[model samples]
Target: MSEVVTRTERPAQRPVHRPVFLTRRRTYLWAAGAVLLLALPFYLDRFWLQAGLFAMAAAIGATGLNLLTGATGQLSMGHAFFLAVGAYGYCVFAGDGADGLTGLGLPTWLAAVLAVLVAGVAGGVFSPIAGRLRGAYLGIATLALIFIGQHVLFNARDLTGGYNGRDVPPLSLFGLTFDDRELVVAAVPFGSAEKLWYAGLVLLLAGGLFARGVLRGRPGRAMNAIRDHRVAAGVIGVPVARYRAAVFVLSSMYAGLAGVLLALVFQRTVPEYFGMTLSLDYLAMIVIGGLGSVSGAAIGAAFVSLLPQILTRYSDLLPLVSAPGTGGIAPGEAARYLYGAAVVAVVLFLPGGLVRITARRNRPTPQEDT
Candidate 1:
């Protein structure tokens, strides 16, 4: 006999669309942030403005490093090498050449572009190493870059000004010298602080946007594929070597851009600044901020750069700390201990880094709804 007729009704489904109010809320938040940034220089002193600039620079550098180590699954412990290339590159092209080695006398803007390009070349040269290397070996290979960069800086006496280091020329835009700490900008009463704030904001925006673009588009897919399995990606017709090298090169360029801004803000380029410690510090930031995430890198940069100031300010209050050249544990020493502990805690507890922590908190649990 045929089966008896017994039919079940299917449930209707609704298409998923984001709430309009949610979009509006995000838009409003972004507008508010922009307004706050624009008004910051007016209310802040030069010191505050400078701090903001430094934070932005570090964020940019961290963003690039994050792309390589976090996203591309490559471990690079020598990103500072690229930063050094950028700073020295700018100093060479725009600095006053007392010894006549560099000082091409090019416009600061042009010099900045060239510096970024040179940094890209440096990355390209290192790309093969990244493509062929992995794990501890990759870290060691990249580490060599720091020493190599330092040697070049020290020995390029004609260009780098040896030992003492050389001064960075003030950045000029269409005739306006961005160097003036006292100068005010248009529509802002406190011009100098405003100008610097705006400059930093612009660069940060550019860097963030570029990173977002890379991670959201086709290149991002390639990066993820290679990161997941280089051999498998190659088998599937992915240009693993080319993509790896390109990421390395692009990441280096980002580091260079960061270096150019850093030199401009500090008004000097010293070979000693781009040491192995700087590279390690950046790695710490990536670890603390969250690997493979741009937002995490930014948060990491702020923490790494700003924590020292807070620690120094409060070191006197701590029982084990004292000022340098006067008595107990040096202020710097105490700060280092604090930073080291923080790093250890972060790694031991949150291996995925700060991004995951934030994500976890933001996610809605059944308990949360209740």
Candidate 2:
């Protein structure tokens, strides 16, 4: 009766793999970067802070461009027009009828929000044409926007202050005004730049996260599909035209927000500042950074925006670079040349742009096959 065999069960084996997203190393790196950013205002001077603010603005604008041009395959040459709208719109909405400029006398915070909305509305007005056009045709169509915008900016003296432009009203929020008024924090003099440093960080963080979410979700898939093959996207029930128009408006809103930050930094909004050259620079940023990549856009923006500043700061020490109007290659021109070469090199060899280099280093390699 005792012939029953005692069977032994093997213990369950644990899973060998961990989730690739947000791994320990990545989490640590992000934490370190955040800490560094938070501490920078205390250590760095105003020059560096302003330069960083410019980079942040550029990043915001470039991310929007990438969404439309890189992800959706819609070429836009009038991004600067929307930027101008935002800058001038804020001045008009917030100004108190001073210096021969028109003003709605709204609160600064409301003006900023309305300025962004105005940019979106401007984009919406152009959507019909954008939805129908593609490739070079679309680009050419958008070029007209620059000319039209410039004309209006010059002629609408009360709104844009004509050739001279207009001053940007200081932004206020939650009982704190972002101006040159000195407020000490932790023994640090928090002026407009210092105060705006924190504001810029928050805005950049929010914009990047929102953009990342959009790219990682269903809308991004639809956009990529439309970019890859429009007819196929439509066949698969994607509303190609509607999506294109919507993206244009969204991109314009982003540019608007960037313009607001820039206006605050400079305390002035100039038509010349938002011109074809600016649009071209943004295109260069996305191209050099990586198409359809959020981080790439930011990286490219910082590189392009900072190169000139760095060169100017050390122009005397650097060969072939001199201060503006010094007969040698100007700092801006030098930076342009360097980045122009970088763009060509990226297109020729690294089609994926700078982001690919980072991705490759971070990618894990497989061990020997069993």
Candidate 3:
């Protein structure tokens, strides 16, 4: 088509490097896992099912915080505060309000939704400190929030029910009350645990998928970039502070969601439950499960959530080692000691977390490939 002796222009092309690991095979596996989760409550017993429900909640919270700390390099020691906000928020909005200042008397579901938003706003309020701080300094700032939150929780008598803790109304889904185990699953016997288990499973899966989306998407890349080199990322026009603040707030929202689920499971909302210990436990869950990995978060959540109960059942099986001050090996003391040791053992050997251990079994090594 070009005229004789006419010069032809060439289209410019750039080399594209696509990651081979992300294939259709991986997506299918993920889908299967999600499907399995949905069907879990159908088969499991009440205790296991309830444990699973709580584990998923913890896993969701851990996954979000992991994104902030492990993926985005931001530390938060006040996560329990956000969780407490969620728990109490549900209680406040849904409870009878013995004093009656302003109770929404809203439906449990709607109240829960409002509670999650309140938690997000609470996080947003602390965004500036989180945005400005880093490392131990950030931890200190967040720790202060947890303490301050506890103080406010105690002082806000009209709102928080003052130390005694307010009762959480049983959740109802579409004219069905969840409290009456008999009503949880009308047609099926042994359905309440299974029903709640299924509910927890769905929320967790949704949370996991959401986490996966954020981690694998642009924001995830940006978070990783900031985590690796903040100044460099900033130089490249990434809004580092904005992302940090946003993530902290987002993480808090995740924590709040977990709290809502927690209240649902316990059927009670006690501010004391969301304390420093719980914050530590959540951090431990991520570490033991695998930081920055959704699979790890779930795996870790199951482990930490179930460990206490499992160990408590088997405490008598272990050699009784009485403490220096204790007469008989106190169940509480034994549990604490065992828990500390468990954390130590996991950190010492499984530093990469339980996921790496699980994955290594299936993934071929270079030697195997050769």
Model 1 misplaced stretches (Cα beyond 4 Å):
2-23, 99-101, 185-193, 317-319, 361-370
TM-score of each: 0.89, 0.93, 0.83
Give the CA lDDT, 0 to 100, for residue 324 in model 2: 77
Model 2 spans with C-alpha error above 4 angstroms: 1-22, 368-370
Per-residue alpha-carbon lDDT of candidate 1 for residues 34-104, written as tens digits (9 for 90 to 100): 89988877677766777778889999999999899888889998999999999989988886676556788
Q: Which model scores highest in TM-score?
A: 2
TM-score ranking from best to worst?
A: 2, 1, 3
Candidate 2, pairs of clashing residues? none
Which stretches in model 3 have alpha-carbon errors above 4 Å? 1-44, 98-102, 184-187, 190-192, 316-318, 321-339, 342-348, 365-370
Q: Where does candidate 3 have its weakest 10-residue lDDT segment?
A: 14-23
How well does model 1 score by local distance difference test?
Answer: 0.83
Q: List lDDT for all candidates, in order.
A: 0.83, 0.92, 0.80
The predictions' CA RMSDs to the true structure, in order, are 3.2, 5.7, 6.4
- The deviation in Å at residue 276 for candidate 2 is 0.4
lDDT of 3 by residue, 1-370 (tens): 8769668788886444333453455678879987887766656667777777788789988987898887898888888999999988988888765555346788888998898999999999999988898999999889998888888787787777667666677777787666745643344564556656767776887888998999999999999999999999999999999999899888988999999888888876666888898888888778778878888888877877777655555655656744335565755556556556767877898877888887766564554444
